[model samples]
Target: MADPQDRRPAGAAEVLERLGRLSLRELSMESLLQTVADLATTVLPGDLEASVSLLVRGSPTTVASTGQLAVDLDERQYERGHGPCLHAARTGELTMIADARTDDRWPDYTPRAAERGALSSLSVPLDIDVDEQVSGALNIYA
Candidate 1:
């Protein structure tokens, strides 16, 4: 299988061209999310599902989501107060959920995420607050 980040659709070239030309700081919050959605659509293989979240006060909130399933899964993680994403965001560790159904770590969240078709996920911590611990999370859901 191709690397998920290398996947692209018919119009992906154009979208990537635009994405490459813009900086995140130059875009509005809404535009930033749209750009992320566009990138997720074009850069991910197969179904190309994705969601991005920001951590505030140790809680994760969806900043952008390409589909409902992704949003639901993120919310599930937030609701449970524990999940790979949350842990990764707080501790600045890479969290990988290869298969939510079989992952025993998130007992409360795994089943719900699996029900929403999120088989795997990756959480990358972002240093939103330069003066504090990681203030946000950037999650990639698959």
Candidate 2:
């Protein structure tokens, strides 16, 4: 019989198991988020990079990132005030750009991100709130 773990997606089990072992009480929010960003890149099939974008008091900030590309792309979004990551954080909706070069949803963002070598992107909203004023999203790029 095949092990159930084999049926699961790549890195899913590892990420979940690692997360389960975390001492949430001991880690700061920034540390926890950084771990999540790092874990995200491991699950995807390509050479991916990730970042954690937090929206606080209507401003967006990159709190943690796995690489410089992730941070640069995230900042591009923040500069425009609307991009996959920011949209996901603000709306709690998942945003995906299969190909940044052709994605026109964010005319101001996609082109620049593509120029910077981020050909694809995925932003998953995080249901995290801090003092009723914070929202977040996990952003992945490749």
Candidate 3:
């Protein structure tokens, strides 16, 4: 009998192989960013903005994004140096803005998010490096 993971599908097998390889060595940062953005757009169940941001030398920077809203928000955070995701990256915690219009954080960025039709968002830190130094973040928005 074929292994379930091997029998899933051609693309699935390829992805699994890639992930397995990733686990053994340092992942190409660009490849990882692209993979997450592609998953956000095609695999995820909902219509929401998605992003991947990396912490380089103690600074957060957006590496990839799936939607305009998310890209803009990430840019805002990068430019202004503030946002829920930024805070989350710093503390290595999940962060959410249930309703950006009412959220007190990101005084400048929230309005821009609202103007762009983003109502809420969730941000989670991704484990990339040892010691969990908040290598990056995954964000979902609606």
Candidate 4:
């Protein structure tokens, strides 16, 4: 049974400490990453969602997500072949959409994302080893 008590840490440092102390021996990579995605929402101050996008064999995939909205949006971008997540993943640069409905960039994606209630978003590229042959980004939507 899951614990009823909500004991999430209150600050970024505490969260980082908790994450560092978490046991990974029994946790699958997906579970640990999902926890990171969930923790991102707690660390950021807003009503937002987060997801992890990974590029494997030149195909983008959502490896972890806080909610269906995050996963769905990632999938939408994946199917269309472009979006903040993919851009960040490929370029290892930060991608931010201040106003999805008005953003000139990603003309096809931003508007539809706004229609779905995503007013803004930030995509931060993750640092996976080049030797590993994988690239990814942490996408947050608000």
lDDT of 4 at 4: 18
lDDT of 1 by residue, 59-127 (tens): 568887766776777788788888876777677788888888899997988887777777888876666
lDDT, candidates in the order shown: 0.71, 0.85, 0.71, 0.85
Q: Please report how far candidate 4 places residue 45 from its true position, in Å.
A: 2.0
Number of the top TM-score candidate:
2
Model 4 C-alpha lDDT versus the unseen true structure: 0.85
Q: Please list all clashing residue pairs in model 1, or write none if there are none.
A: none
Model 2 lDDT, residue 66, Cα = 82
Question: Could you report the Cα RMSD, in angstroms, for every candidate shown?
Answer: 5.0, 5.9, 7.2, 3.0
Deviating ranges (above 4 Å) for candidate 4: 1-9
lDDT (Cα, tens digit) per residue for candidate 4, span 1-142 = 1121332436988789879987899788778878888777777766678899999867889999887889999999999999999999988899999999889888889888999889999999987867647889999999
Model 1's TM-score against the true structure: 0.76
Per-prediction TM-score to the true structure, in the order listed: 0.76, 0.89, 0.72, 0.89
Model 3, 1-142: lDDT tens per residue? Answer: 1222332223555555655655425557676675666554443344576788888767787777765677788878888887877877777799988998899778898888888888888888776778765477888777
> lDDT for model 3, on a 0 to 1 scale?
0.71
Error of 4 at 51 (Å): 0.6
Candidate 2 per-residue lDDT, tens place, 16-122, comes to 99899999899998998898887776677666788999999889999999888889998888888999999999889999999988899999999988888899999
